[model samples]
Target: SAMFRDYLSRFSLNPKQKFKTLSRGMKMKLGLAAALSHDAKLLLLDEPTSGLDPVMRDEILDILRDYITAENKTVFFSTHITTDLERIADYIVYIFKGRIIYSGLKDELLEKYCIIRGGEDDLLKIDRNILIGCRKHYGGFEAMIDIESIGGLPSGVVTEKVTLDDIMIFMNRKGENSCF
Candidate 1:
């Protein structure tokens, strides 16, 4: 079929290969090819890039990026690979333990929270209530805090932009009393 041919031309998998024997990547490509051949407006993929080599992962991402923008199709995929979301997701939905913790624009979420790092003396300047999570080492300390919660701390403390992974880690670190 034209769909399989198009896919094979790019991914280099044998069309005649037994489904049971095909590599996982090949099976994934075949499934994607079948999906693309249809007229569906929405595609739901679960960890499509999982277990794939970097090159194959890049190829799939390229195909998805193209399909999304060019075809105007919506892709709803769940990935523990937060970097993949950074590359393609417009919105983020963070669900943990059957609870929807966050659902909003990715940029907005990133802008609202950050990691603050400074010397041990800085701990006294920080308000404990404002910190979502904190680490107090001998020389320095790092804590996760919302931008709005940052009151009048002096100029020496530095705030670093957080990645999705950082957010997930800090979210786990947060206590039950968290305002999340």
Candidate 2:
């Protein structure tokens, strides 16, 4: 009961509120309260912040942060909100279709890959083999390549940091010829 009360207090949730009558954020808070009430050391969450407003979503992230750091617990979180992934996840496992494409520390993955942009001439100058995935638009081309492959690229191209969302998009567009 104390555990339930504690989590509820953190989320500003009232104890007696009917489940269906509550807002989306309230419902998620209630669910979290119930899950953590039994002294749960591991939380397996899928889209935990879905349908909630930005403020509520950030509050949930804060709660999870405190849960992991202060309490030394583990949260196996799943969400489409890439910003949330950047904020809360220390590691990332990327699953495209049924296969695991990338699995390891989040920072390492971000460090390992980057997006390079340039015109068609740029593509001709660099080795296409370096690209994990690439797209050619009307004006130019942008490709996801490992940071290790940077040396093989042309001097005039623009390279930028790749986020988890960007990797996901590139991986989707990679098709059957993926570098995996």
* Candidate 1 all-Cα RMSD: 2.8
Reference-based lDDT, residue 141, model 2: 83
lDDT of model 1 at residue 1? Answer: 70
* lDDT scores in order: 0.82, 0.84
Off by over 4 Å in 2: 175-180
How large is the C-alpha RMSD of every model relative to the true structure? Answer: 2.8, 2.6
lDDT of 2 at 75: 92
Give candidate 1's error at residue 78 in angstroms.
0.9
What lDDT does candidate 1 reach at residue 10?
Answer: 73
Cα deviation of 178 in candidate 1 (Å)? Answer: 13
- Who wins the TM-score comparison? 2
Cα error, candidate 1, residue 51 (Å): 1.4
Score candidate 1 by TM-score against the native: 0.89
TM-score of each: 0.89, 0.91
